[model samples]
Target: MLSKDALDTLFTNARTHNAWLDKPVTDAQLQEIYDLMKWGSTSANCSPARIVFVRSDAEKQKLLGCVSQGNFEKTKTAPVTAIIGMDMEFFEKLPQLFPHADARSWFAGNQANIDATAFRNSSLQGAYFMLAARAVGLDCGPMSGFDADKLNAVFFAGTTVKVNFICNLGYGDAQQLFPRSPRLSFDEACKIV
Candidate 1:
């Protein structure tokens, strides 16, 4: 089992940062985050999450155009912004990913099944991405305040991938964090079988 400090790093004390320090997130660190998050579970091992780390000024500028005004400044200032996307064609690789079974045949021509699996599994991967970022000593500011159609055009124009959400990653400014908000109690938010 993980120690208390590790648990705190992953969950209890981790905060969604809105302000970032002036530090760079290296390509190696970004790769490390992916290498960790890639191990997360997905339906049928379909593993549909695709990430684009926007660090260059050119890419960041393109991304800035699609975000809501509320998200603009923080996104612009963060060391890197990860565009989490879902591959609509993810099932094609199921033969390679879930090789033990003919998982590819299950959704090859079925649009509804493909869409449901891609979106759900990719969303789960996005959560795993955030935890992996924290594990790598990076702060995350995840947000959905962006124009998906515009972002898809900018990042994945002719591909079958669709934008899931975006997250800014870097060292955060602690002074900028707000007070931690309340969460639902287990009795209020959960149920026993």
Candidate 2:
């Protein structure tokens, strides 16, 4: 079993941090987070997630226009806001990530399969990203309270990528947090069929 500290750091102690310090998240740290997330599992290793880190004022302004009002201030003030996305042309990389067979052709011309694979893998990557950020001592505010189509139009225009979610990354201000919310008990949330 994992230590109590490990479990707490990853779950009980982690909060959805909305307020941040003005400190910056270094590019090296961002790359390290991606490196850690890349090792996490995915179907056929389709690893479709693509992230764009928006840190500049102009970029932040563009992102601000795309986010919902509830998320605007937190995102705008974040040291980095990752635009987690899925690449539609992800199958092209199958040769490197899943080379045991002709897996690339399996997704060709199959829109349903393509959509399923991209969304699933990208979602998995997002989860991995959050865990990795926590492991690296960074605070995360993951949100889906935005228009995906507008985000795509603003950030991913002319590209085959679509935004899956936005994660504001930085050092969290615990004082700004509300009291912790309750979660379901094991028996209430799970079934051991």
Best by TM-score: 1
> How close is every model to the real structure, measured as TM-score?
0.99, 0.96
lDDT of 2 by residue, 16-83 (tens): 99999989899899998999999999999999999999999999999998889999999988999999
The CA lDDT at 91 in model 2 is: 94
lDDT for 110 (candidate 1): 97
Model 1 misses residue 39 by how many Å? Answer: 0.6
Which residue runs does candidate 1 get wrong by more than 4 Å?
A: none
List RMSD in Å for every model shown: 0.6, 1.2
Model 2 stretches astray by more than 4 angstroms: none
